[model samples]
Target: MLKKLGVLAATGMIMTALTGCGSSNNDLTTNKDTAKPGSEKAASGDTGLLNGAGSTFVNPLFSKMFSEYSKEHADVKVNYQSIGSGGGIKQLTAKTVDFAASDAPMKDDELKAAGGNVLHIPVTLGGVAIAYNLEGVKNLKLTPENIADIYNGKIKKWNDPKIAADNKGVALPATDIFPVHRSDGSGTTHIVTTYLNAAVPAKWTKEQTGKSVKWANVGTGAKGNEGVAGQVQNTPGSIGYVELAYVIQNNMTAASIKNKDGQFVAPTLETVTSAAKGALTTIPEDLKVKLSNQPGKDSYPIVGTTWVLVPENLTLDKAKAEKMLTMLKWAVTDGQKYAGELNYAPMPKELQDKGVEALKKVKVNGEAVLK
Candidate 1:
């Protein structure tokens, strides 16, 4: 399959893209000739630049969304860094970037440290797939116990009875199992840990749920989602959890995790959509909520929602703020059409309306930033 549009190579290249510009909005310039009537560029003569960093898990989707957005509104440019979620939050707190994207919601300490009040803008919903690179494996079924034991070092071999029992009649290998995990602070890690904690309380309880966790001695660590996916693809008998987009991009074998209904469900657009529908109903005023291990018969077990961090008050030039707001509004509305094509679950219309309401609250000197 063709690599999804705008999915760039990860690691150092991510930072290079951000710093190469000298500043986030520096290169943006008014394109008077290309401006459209009633368009954001027509209204605001300011250079249309929006800078964001964080969540390698969402990088591919954002890359597609932003690229398609530029096609429609030629004046605006968005530069996003695929650094780990921790780096994104740090840059946002320091006021060095226009916004930040995080898979995990900010902790209380992080919220207190922000130079300006931050708002959580929920973006697309997705799932974390437990994918493996076994030479002859096909359709692996992992129960809650099987997953817990594999990560906590209780199960060392691919042919372990617990895993075999879940997939009867399948040939099982006696090779040692290598568990791969994220080395960086990441929302993907948080979602996996959160699911583990809820699905297998006894083992995952000892390890707190966060972007970074203490892996059992048996597991190895890799940097970003791309790093983990690369390690799993190259190393046989290795299993790692990553967003569904990576699974699709790499064509790796994903495991079916046992859900709350006791059915082993694979991560697909339909299952993840079911999970999001059940979880998005009660989104709090803050818009920070986890969608993993949701209750539903067909729901995938390890789903999560990603958020874009924006300031409640616009401290940047009003033109820049308006431009940023315009592009963001487009992402949740018109930009949603590209989501399903990329294997991401678009927010439901009702929840999207609420998200738009939150975006409308952004203001400059106590007035709405975008008219």
Candidate 2:
């Protein structure tokens, strides 16, 4: 089942060590681009150095996409910092980075703070796996109620009746249940909490859903997806929600979560893509849409679309703005190919078209950049 679900083994896979709060400088080779010279070079005739920060959830995909993009446009260098979504938005508002990536969409206040020009461009979709470390347990199924209670600190034992009821034939241990969560402001937290709120609305309130919540005062707190995954990997009886890529990268066990359709679906490329169906139809003009707890029976319950945050009227200089828009145009189009290998679902054709249209609105001193 795991192999059929496309979960890669950890044996020969090499995990790239990304810095927690700084830019990655991994050396990559360059390739030639076929785009017109005007779009390729900055107006000032200087190299374009674009800096971005945010969302560890999309770090794996961004790493590959940026590296591949640099390969084609050697004159443009993108330095992305994986310091969670909140930090990315903060940097974007502060005008410190050329752009930012986030799993969660910016709030109304955030938009106003950035002069209300920020555009949320949907780039990729992915699932948040309920990763756990338990001896002799390979396939674990969890219902929404079970998950709510476990995270709320109400279900502290592995052999609790609620958990045991779901797995009748399995050997249940009496170990203490440790729920891990992100210590920093995280878009992964926002998705999980939002799903929890949707799944068990009575238990998980709307007030408790956001990039950072007061996490029920239980479990341990880790910094990023890497931190939560590492915590679950090292601590027995520990469970945490992380991106599907992290789960597969660490070769950790992920639970099959019960979706709104009453089906327990595992996080896989197909399942995550299934959740993304019809998302474009509901997305507003802003392009900020949620994919969690979608209605498909085959859909993974904890799926979300990650976006790149760029201002419609860029704050950067004309030369840098042109380069940034060009890079973004390529990302929503060509950059999507690298998503699946990194455990992310590429944006649907309709959404990609919408993204291209939105990118057309990006301007440098009232002049469009794409043309």
TM per candidate? 0.87, 0.90
- Candidate 1 lDDT, 96-206, residue by residue in tens: 668788899998889889855688888888889998989877788998778888988999999998898888988989999999988888889888888889988987883
* Per-residue C-alpha lDDT of model 2 across residues 3-30, encoded as one tens digit per residue: 4223433222224432221223343211
> In terms of lDDT, which candidate is strongest?
2
Candidate 2 deviant stretches above 4 angstroms? 1-14, 17-47
User: What is the lDDT, from 0 to 100, of the residue 121 in candidate 1?
Assistant: 85
User: Which residue pairs in candidate 2 have backbone atoms (N, alpha carbon, C) closer than 3 angstroms, thus clashing?
Assistant: 31-71, 55-84
Name the runs in model 1 displaced over 4 angstroms.
1-46
